[model samples]
Target: MSPQPPASAAALRARAETAGLHLPGLILAAEQLAAQVSPGAHGLRRAGPGEDFWQYRPASAGDGMRAIDWRRSARSDQDFVRDREAQTAQTAAIWVSGGQGMAFSGASDRETKAERARLLALALAMLMLRGGERVGLLGQRARSGRLQAERLAEALVAAPAAQADFDAPDAGALRPRQRVVLIADFLARPDWLPGFLAQAAGLGTTGVILQLLDPDEESFPYHGAVLFRSQSGALRHESRDAGALRGAYLARLAERRDWLAAQAGAAGWRYVHASTGDLPADSLTELWQMMGR
Candidate 1:
């Protein structure tokens, strides 16, 4: 597939200025992506104390007499219990890392990690909203409806640039039993992560940690006489034979991914990995399934 054309600075600024008045291109793209997935029974069609009818099943020993549909039961020899669809909307908070490292793209044709993260976050939020779930930024209150999706897009566009090389999730923003989606490249191993996961477990907050990386970061395609610099220019390394470091670099990357996966599992959450080169819709499909679970 052809790469998406980069947005001009002037156009971006104009879109930001008119954010609330109309849907931005980013939101439109997210909507298009979200529309691709079918919103089939998204864990909301379960039997519960809701107004809408879900299904009818044979009455069991524990089934209360009030729940028994006598009208329907009369037609059949066995008694049936009326089940209603669960109407409780789940709250989801999505966070994209605002780190300097996220702004780096390996090539002009590829999107920056930040760009991909925001797109996925917004698209996932749109899908959840379509499934009758409330969504918002990590630090904000979750709300339902199309307006909330628009507000999430606006918030993502207006987010301030990063001043640091890496960022950690805001544990204080988490609420009990709230679902969260955090998208970031954990190259630096956020020192706050362990504590955050512990707190999330304590509060019963389940979530998914998505590790997004640039193709260059994943492959480390450097050769002789290379200089590597952090996105913030806070750190630098020069190597006469950069290709020789590939083995060590890849090993560390794998170790980090394993560590993250273990942490997520320990906390009853899930871990997902994706690269900018992959299709956003593919990752969104996986996220949709995880959220439904």
Candidate 2:
């Protein structure tokens, strides 16, 4: 699959500035945010000049003149200088739910829940990348780089997310401080979330989860003998007694919802809960603000 088109930070910021016009009060600007997200040892800096010494290279066009290290240039007797950049203020890792059950949410207009997930994934990735934060895919393949943000969108567009092994900690050394932003339906209580978050938190990581709930998910709205298949997570059922279990089902769903919120809150995680056809950016900002970014 192809990585997303590489849009300059300015172009991306401009797009985000105008994206949520459909919903008033939902618009936000990530441009002014400081770089603090680092998911690995290398500071997650934009491929431009800032604070940390990311790498050095011979001076070239578009390279900030100040980035040239004169001492190195003198030694080589060439135009060589240190290419310093800002420390990644945040590591915005995105977790998309591709559990088998996510497919239950049927298509709308020309899009299915899968497409919506991809859209959210791309939009948020762009927002974070635009803000100069390091953005990466979580469930599918996690990566962090200036242009790697676009890879995530293309992956989502090319394939549905594979089931996430939340228990498996991400590898590689990230910046000491990082922020993780998750987007998922969280349908099944998969046995992986707590472990993942704990590991990241150990490294001074904060989290934000955008719970994407489908309408039918909250309600066992299906009646009659109906067969269902799961999307990413493992859950299958052909309920004949759905009517009788409706009350218990509702109660259980409510309990799960409350528990999820409490868990995230207790862990100092920012939660942005949404359903299909809903707005996600405004709440995303709220979470970014909460981490003191």
Candidate 3:
């Protein structure tokens, strides 16, 4: 993969302009939705070095004087050792498919698959940040906090072109023991998935795949005199009657989803499907619940 495009001043401004119409709303909605989920739900619980107070235990042999809480010891008449919760934040590597197919939207009321996937990524990042976890784009290094989300969102929108039909992310970018989330239409025949999953497993990275599809892509609700144009504009198919293709299309879609689920299981990851028409908050909530578990 080529080096990530630097976020120069011009590049940042162009990214902002590219997403100007959607950015504000996306950010606000993400913040509001993330606020609904409590951070403690995903916090790591243990006793170790940390800032938050956990509890006090009776000081024992080998305990250093610095470990004793003098104030607490005076009150209890016994030497007490301060213990703090070791809240180790997890790293979540996130990816959104920017395939040409993702630009397809079935209706004016709904956002394009790419738009919905990007917004979902941002929203999920907000939730992870609030939970005290680190987040990064799949090919990038992870970072924590709200500011990182802004930086990521900017970079996501700034990329000049969509990924190839079956381009897998660079697994070398992933750190061991990290969690990953991928949001994509999954319309392409994925020849690269098995190798990618194998590498991810080798790196000790567990993952979740969020399959986002447009309503029309799922239902195939079209009839007479239908013409379909490929998102890449490389092909066109015209049909005297599109309804005739519904059965086969639906079957193929089901098979694809099933294969995705099975492969995710084999790789020790979970898969979830969401339609573009559904509430983004609901998907975000479900993902958070799954990660916490």
Candidate 4:
């Protein structure tokens, strides 16, 4: 069996009780990372000698018993943590592409691409948030700095399965100096990537573009004649030329990968392309180390 998690990881089994669901170990493991960074929240809770201080407030009907402060209750007639004002954390925002394409899983038995994406996104988000960095989620419904992992997971499941048109983010919606992490498969047309990177570079912001893809995306593993369909169902193929087109198809894919890497180098962005088969924990930890974390 895996060794017992760090004591700080108590937040996980604890969070599930609040969410009224059995959240996965992935989230708990990510919470271990989150403990590194102090997350900011608005509420009534005890403030201790932690590097990051959080104020708690009177218990709302929804607060879990775990979040309650029995010590404060013993002192005051009211049950609560010290209700402090809401404060913003100095955290980087993580924008995960929620296009339908992420929902695909080529042949992974553990989970689908979308599932992996969720695991990665949530883990990263929690990790950053723990370090006192506010996490802003970008998708069809963008939200940030909220203790809503369970809600976010549900949203990921219901989100529309289409890559963004790869265009500019909304004007002023993205800050230039903030640390920004962009995670996506980036399988869509490549029209908007240049502008996106250019704008981010101009802001003097350093970040990573985590491109998550299946093995097949890198290697066209179609050995036999077969029908293929895009996530959008806009394209359908009945092909017998898998061998004939294999060469051209692979060449085009290489060019695209090279183009993406070249663009990142030009704009001073860290690029990490992760395969679904990769052990996400190790890959993500390596990424942080590469970032000089």
How big is the positional error of residue 144 in model 4, measured in Å on the Cα after superposition?
9.2
Q: Per-model C-alpha lDDT, please?
A: 0.87, 0.56, 0.80, 0.62
What TM-score against the true fold does each predicted structure earn? 0.83, 0.57, 0.78, 0.63
lDDT tens per residue, model 2, 1-293:
97766678666656555543412211112211212222123343555545566676788886677767888788786787576665544565665655544554553543345545556565556555655566676534344554564466445544433564222224243334556666666656745666666666677767676666666666567777776656543445787756777898788777767777777777677666666655444444444444333
* TM-score (C-alpha, index-matched) for candidate 1: 0.83
The TM-score of predicted model 2 comes to 0.57
The positional error of residue 4 in candidate 1, measured at the CA in angstroms, is 38
**Candidate 4 residue runs with Cα over 4 Å from true position:** 1-26, 32-89, 108-110, 139-158, 163-172
* Model 4 poorest 10 in a row by lDDT: 37-46
CA lDDT, candidate 1, residue 236: 98
The reply for model 2, stretches above 4 Å from the true place, is: 1-88, 107-110, 139-149, 159-175, 232-235, 279-293
lDDT (C-alpha) at residue 264 in model 4: 77
Q: Find the candidate with the highest TM-score and give its number.
A: 1
Ranking by TM-score: 1, 3, 4, 2
For candidate 3, lDDT tens digit of each residue in 116-219? 77777887888788777888998787899778977877766765556443345666777788889878888776777788788889988888988889989999
TM-score, prediction 3: 0.78
